[model samples]
Target: MSILYYGLSNSSIDNCTDVDEKVKHHYLPVCYGTIFIIGVVGNITALLVYLVKVRPWKSSTIIMVNLVVTDLLFMICLPFLTYYYSQYDSWMLGIIMCRFTRFIFHFNLYGSILFLTCLAIFRYVAVVHPMHANSIKQKRWGTLACILCWAVAVAEISPIFNQIEMKLQDNKTYCFDLASNNPEFMWPYSWVLTVVGYLVPLVVVCLCYWRIMKELKKGPHKESKKRVRARRLIVLILTCFIVCFLPFHVLRALRIYTRLTPETNCMLDRWAHAAYIISRPIAAVNVILNLLLYTLSGDCFKQAFVEMFRCDRLVSKTKDIVKVAVISKPTTKITHDQSS
Candidate 1:
C-alpha cells in the first residue's frame, strides 16, 4: 500500500523510479511520521479514556474500544513502512516483518469493516429486536464478537502472504505485487478482495443501519437526545466509510480491468493512479475523524476529553481550596499542633 502511493504519484518522472530514494528523502518519512504521531496519540488517548475513565463499558463502547485498538495496531507498523519507503522500498526488515506488516494491514482493514458492520447490526438488533439485543449486550458477548471478527479478518487476509513477495528492480529491492505481472490471477484476486473486504460489508452496514434508523423513528427512544446523537454518529461513520473507501475501490477495479487487457490506455491508468493517490490520505483521515465524531457526539467522550486535557483542573483546585477553608476551625487542634 505504501509503495503503491509512492510509485503511482511519481510514476511520471523516469529518474525518480527508485522506490527507496523516493521514500527515504520524501514519501515514507512524511506519511509514516504523520500517521505515527496522530495515530499513536489519538488512539492511545481514546483507549485510555474508554478503559480507565469510562469503567462501566456498554456493548457500544466495547465496539468503539476495539476499533481504537485496531487502528493502533495499524499505526504501530507505520514506522517500518516509513523506513522502507525512506530506503526506497527496500525490505531490510527481513521477510518476517514484511509478511507480518502486510498481515496487520489487511487484518485492520477487514477487522475495521467487520466491526463497523457488527456495530450496525448491534444497532439494528437493539432497535428492531430489543429483547434479543438485551440478552447479548454483555461484555462477554462483545468479546466473543471481537474474537470472531479477528478470526475472520485473519482468514481473509491470509492470502496476502502468499501473493506478496520482494523483487529487485534496477538492483534496488522493493516489496510489491509479484502477482501484478500475472493479470489473470491479479484481476480475480482484486475483485474478490473488493467484494469480500469492502462491497459486501458495506452493503450489510448500510442495510442494517437503514433498518435500525427506521425502527428508531417508531420506537420509544426516538425522542431522546441520546438516540438523536446515536443516529448522527451512525450517519457520520457511514458517510466517512463511503467517502474514504469508494473511490479507492472503484479505481482499483478499474486498474485491474486495465491490467487484464492488452490494449494500453495510459490515460485511464493515469486517472486511476491519481484517484488511488488521493484515496490513500483519505484512509488516514478516516482514523482521525473518528476521534472528532466521538468527541462531538458522545457525552461520555466529551467529558473524558475535557478531563484528559485537564480543563477541569482549575475547578478541582478551587473545590479543594473551598474544602480546606470550610474544614478549618478556630479552636483546639490547630493551636495545639502549632504549640507542640
Candidate 2:
C-alpha cells in the first residue's frame, strides 16, 4: 500500500523529480515480482491444503482462509504493477485498470491487517478466555467478521478514485501512485489512514496479545506445550506487525509530512523518500509471515502437510505400499472435528 511517494513539491532544491526515478524504475519491478511469485505460490498451496486435508475449519482457521484469499487478491494485481514499473510508470493499462489495481492493492493491504487482528483476537479468546471463547468464536461470527473487514477496507480505499488520476507527462501517460500528487487529498486522507487504518488495528492486536501474555503468566500454564506453541505464534504475529507494518507506516507518514512541510530539508526529505520506498516492500513481506502462521497455528494443517510428504520417507521395501496408497480409493472418513 505504501508503494511510491516522493520528495516535496516546492523544494528549494530538486523536488519530487529529484527522488531518483532510476531507483524507482529498477526497484519496484523486482520487489513486486518477488512478492507476486512467493505470495501466489504460498497462498495457493495453503488454500489447496486447507481444501483437501484441513477438514472442519475453526473460527481462527476461517479467518486464515480469508487472509489467504486476501493475499491472492493482491497477487493478481502485482503483474500489472510489475509491468508498469518495468517500463517505469508508463501505464499501458487503461485508466480504469490503473485505478482498479490501485484499489485492490490498498484493499488487500488493509484487509490483511484487519483479518490478522481478528485472528489475534480470536486466538486470545481461545487462549485467555476459553470459558467464553466457545460462544464468541463461532464460524458464523468469523464469516461475519470477514465480510465486515472487506466492506470497511473497501470504504476506506474507495476515495482513491478521486485522488489518483491518469496524467500525461512528457508525452507518456502515467497512473498515479497511492502518494497522489494532489496535496489537497494526499496528506489529509493519509493521516486519516494512519490513525484509523493502521493505529487502531495495531492497538487492538497489542491489547489482545498483552492480555494473552498476562493470562499465560498467571500459573504453570506457561510450561504446557500447547500454551508454548500459542506463545510462539503470538510472538510471530507481533513481530510481523512491528517489523514489517510499523516501519512502513511511520516512514510513509514521515515522507508525506515532509511533502507537506515546505521548510523541510531536501536531503532529509530525499532520505525519507528513499526509506519510505524501501519500506513498501518490507510491508509486503507479511505475506510470507502469514504463510508461516498458517502452517504453525493449526495441527490439522501441520498434520496434513506431514502426511502428504510421508511418501518420500518410504523405503525400497515399501514400494508396494506406496503404489497401493497411490492407486487405492481414499476411504478416510471425517467423523468429527479433528482439529487437533
Candidate 3:
C-alpha cells in the first residue's frame, strides 16, 4: 500500500536512472522479518487473552480484539513481501496474488487506523459521559462499528486492486510495483486514502483523546485506576499516530506529488523513494508497538500471561507429586488395608 505507485513512467525510467533498488531490497527483508516475528507473537497472545481470559467482552475488549485482528492480518502478509524483496524484484505469484496482497495491505492499514479512532471515541464517551457510557459501551455497538470499518476499508481498496498491474522488467516480474498506467484513476484513489482514509481518522483520534484528557482532569474519577489507564492508553495511541502513521502519510503524499507532477525529476524521485523506504517500516512497526502499549496500559495483561503459565506449571508439578506418591506408597497401602 505504501509503495502502490513505486514505478517510473517510461520516459522517466529512461531519464532518471539513479535510484538504487539494492537499498530497498536489502533493508526491507530485515525490517519486515523482524516485524513478522514480533507482530505475530504479540498479536496472537493478545487475541488469546482477549478471547479466553477476558470474559463477557465489553466495548473496549471488542475493540482491542478487532485491532489485534487487523494487526495480525497485516502481519500475515509480511512474509510474502519479505520473499518478494529477497528475490530482488521477482514476483513469482502472478497478477491475482499481486492484487490480493495489495488489497489486504491497504485494508489492514486503514482498518487499524479506523479501529483505533473508534476506540478513542468509545473511551472518550465512556469516561466523559458516564451517564451515557452504557449507550456507547455496549458490545453490540462495538461489533457494528467494527463491521462498518471493515466494509469501508474493503470499499476503499477495491479500486486499487482493480488497477494493479504486473509489469515485466529486465526478465523479472514486478507485482503492483509499477506506477498505474492510468493517472486519472490513480490520483483520485490516492486522494481517497490520503484524505478520507488517513486524515479524517487522525483528526478524530486526536480530538477524542484531547477531550478525554480534559474531562479526566476535572472529573470525579480523576484519581481512579480506570482514569489512569485511560490516560495511559490515550498517550500510547497518540504516540503511535505521531511515530507510525504521521511519517507514512506525509511521505505518501510527497510520493504522490512527485510521481504525478510535471516537474518531477530523478532527484525528487530519489528523495521520495528514500524517505518512503524509511517511513514505511516505521508505519509497520505499529503492530509490534501495540504489544508494548498493551503491557504498559495496566497490569492486567501481564497478570493474565503470568496466570496462564503459572496454572500450567502448577498442574505439571501436581502430576509429578502424584506420580512419586504412587511409585513409593504401593506396598504400604496394601499392608494398611490388610490390618483394617
- Candidate 3: tens digits of C-alpha lDDT, residues 1-340: 2233434342435555434365678888899899999889889888887666765677766777888898998986789988998887689987888888777777777888888888888877877788988888678988998998888888877886678778776788877532333555666667778789888988998888888888889937588877787778888888888888888878766766677775566667767766777777788887877786666544366567667657668878999999999987987888899999
Candidate 3 residue-wise lDDT at 249: 77
lDDT of 2 by residue, 196-278 (tens): 88889999999999999888888775688777877888888888888988888888777777777767766676777777778
Q: Please give the CA lDDT of all the candidate structures.
A: 0.69, 0.79, 0.75
- Provide the global lDDT of candidate 1 against the true structure: 0.69
Best by lDDT: 2
- 2 against 3, candidate with superior lDDT: 2
- Candidate 2 versus the native: TM-score? 0.84
Assess the local accuracy of residue 3 in candidate 1 as a C-alpha lDDT between 0 and 100.
Answer: 32
Clashes of 2: 0
- Write down the TM-score of every candidate: 0.77, 0.84, 0.82
State which candidate, 1 or 2, has the greater lDDT: 2
How close is each model in CA RMSD to the real structure?
A: 8.5, 10.0, 8.8
